[model samples]
Structures are given as structure tokens and as C-alpha cells.
Target: MHERVATTPSLMIKRRLNATPAEVFEAWTDAKLLMQWFGPENVVTQEVSVDAQVGGGFRVVMRENTGERHEVRGTYSEVVANEKLVFSWSWITTPERVSRVSVTFKPDGAAGTILTLLHEQLFDEQAVKGHTHGWTGSLAKLEALFA
Candidate 1:
């Protein structure tokens, strides 16, 4: 008999944005704003649908420069305006490999917000690295929005 071993990897990212906590939170909850900065730099967001409430859901479709499309969907588990959000995340094509993402926003003095993102329950180390790269790129775009 063979025994199966499972691995769970996680990643955390911190970003400082030149915007208020409310503005940063709005960028996440508002579908239009989300699409503008959600994906990696080389991918274009094709469509975005967001229902910003606890138990609500969101879907995002992104098209790579190569014309390939990737879709992700998730349901909100917790929502606290201008403070925090927790959601379940899964790719449409790999729904079985579900993960969770939590984002916290705090005021950084009077001029900015400190944003922390934690992604957990990843399937493996590869997933952790991939998500880290993706989130790094996406957060750069989010920062540009306030620049």
C-alpha cells in the first residue's frame, strides 16, 4: 500500500500605498478598480465581477499577451470595511486546489496605508512561489494607481 503525503505552503506580502485605508479597500472591493490592477503586469484583465460582502463571490478573467486566458473565482469569507478581507480562492481550471487569502489594511500615519496579504493552504511549494510572484507584480500595479 502507498501512503500519500500532502504539503501546504503559504506566502505573505506587505505593501505601502500612498492612499488611505478606505481607498485601498475600495480598490479591492470595486470591480472596476480591481480589474485595473488585479493581474500580473503582462496580463490584461478581460472581465471582472465582484459582490463585495461576506459570503459574496468574485470572478476575474485575464488574458495573457499570448492570448491565453486564465480565470479565477472566489467567495468572500469575511469582510470588514477599510480593515480586512478574507476569501477563498481557486482557479476555475483547478478548483480542487483551493486556497485562502486574507488582506489587512491599516493607516500608515496620515498619508498612506499599510497593506498586508497572506495567502495560505496552497497545494505545494510551487504554488507558493507562483502566487508570490503574481502578487508582487499585481501589487506594483496597485501602487501605480496611487502614484
Candidate 2:
């Protein structure tokens, strides 16, 4: 007989932005634009570097109001202009726990973009919860950009 173990579920998040797919994609790939709305509310972006292509990498550092710094780095696995992007994500502090993130941009009617984000391979349930919180906050900031 073989034993099996259960795994944590992947996180899926969706948002609708009042902008075109190109604009939403640019906000993700362009370092300058990303820095403007990459982190949670009240978290200041200290540094941002992005190479928006397959096999390229990105790094973002944010400082909280309490001066705590959080850094995340990732490598691009797939990139489709204004359509989709897939990447590997790992925290600088815990590179051993690598995860994958995929984002798809779909045109909604004529002006809005429907953004779907799926984050998988999380190490544990705690990671899923933490990422859910972080992503929710980040997405809110991203949404504000188009408002």
C-alpha cells in the first residue's frame, strides 16, 4: 500500500480594472509603473527592477510605515504581451520556498480589463493565507491607479 499526502490549495484572485489590457500589462511589466502600485497600502516602494521577458527576472523591495522591509524576486517563465504572464516567485529571505504566479488579461467590453491571477506551489496553508492578504492589498493599490 502507498500513502498519500494532501497539499495546500492554490490561491486564485480576480479583479476588473477600468483600463485596456495593454495598460494593465504595462503596469505589471514596467518597473516605474510597477513601483507606483506594487505593494500594499502605506508600504513605500524602495526599489524595483524588471526584465519583462521569458527567462528574465524582477525584484521589488517595499518598506512599511514601521520601516520593515520586504523583498521579493522572481524570474519570468512566460510572457505574452497584453495577454498573459507566468513567473516564479520567491522571497529573498526564503528562497527555498519557490512558488509560481500566472496572470491573464482579458478585454472586458471595450474599455475594461479582467485580470485573473493564480498563485500556486505555496509551501503551506500559512503561505497561502499570507499571500492572499498581501495580494489583496497589492491589487487594491493597482486598482486605485485606474481610478
Candidate 3:
């Protein structure tokens, strides 16, 4: 008999933006701005649907350079104006890929905003590492947008 196995991996990323919390939050809630910096260099996201309100859902198809497409679906679990966002996310390509993400926006002492991201329920160490880099790079793109 095969024994039960469990695999859960996670990654967290925090970034500071040279903008206000409201501005950062707007970038996320606004689909147009979100498309400006949501994926990798060769990947583009086509947002099929987005309902930003709490309990509302969103789905987007990410197309890679080679035209490979992946679908991501999520629903907003919680939202606080200019402060925090919590959501349940999963990839349609990977059934077991389930995660809850929390993002906090705080005002920096000076004139910036600190964005703290917490991603939980990954599948393995490799996934955690890959996602770390992926998230960091994406955040960089976001910073570029504000700059």
C-alpha cells in the first residue's frame, strides 16, 4: 500500500513602492494598470473577467512567448481600502495548486508605500523558489510603472 504524502510550499515577497498606498492599491484593482506589470517579460495576461469587489471573482489567461497559455482564477476574500487584500487563488492547469495570498499596503515614513505580500500553500521547495523569483521580478515591473 502506498503511504499518504503531503506537499505544501509557500513564498513571501515584500516590496516598497515610491508611491502612496492608494496608488499601489489602485494598480492592483485596476485591470488596465495590472496588465502593465503582472507577468514575465515574454508573458502577457489577457484578463477575461475581473470583479474587484469582495467575494467577486477574476480570471486571466497568461500567454507565454511560445503561445502556451495558463489560466488563473481567484476570488477576493477580503479587501480594505488602501490597506490590505486577501484572496484565494489557484491555477487551472494545476489542480492542486491552491493558495491564499495576503497583501498589505502601509505608508512609509517618508513619502512611499510599503507593500507586503504573503503567499501561502505552495506545493514544494522548488515551487517556492521559482515563485519567489517570479514575484520579485513582477514587483520590479510594477515599480517601473510607478517610476
- The regions of model 1 sitting more than 4 angstroms off are 1-7
Better of 2 and 3 by TM-score: 2
Write down the lDDT of every candidate, Cα atoms only.
Answer: 0.94, 0.93, 0.82
Question: Where is the poorest 10-residue window by lDDT in model 2?
Answer: 1-10
TM-score of each: 0.94, 0.93, 0.87
For candidate 1, the lDDT comes to 0.94
Best-to-worst order by TM-score is 1, 2, 3
Candidate 3 stretches greater than 4 Å from native: 1-7
lDDT of 1 by residue, 7-58 (tens): 5788999999999999999999999999999998789998999998998999
Among all candidates shown, the one with the greatest TM-score: 1
Off by over 4 Å in 2: 1-7
CA RMSD, predictions in order = 5.0, 3.5, 5.4
Report how far residue 46 has shifted in candidate 2, in Å: 1.0
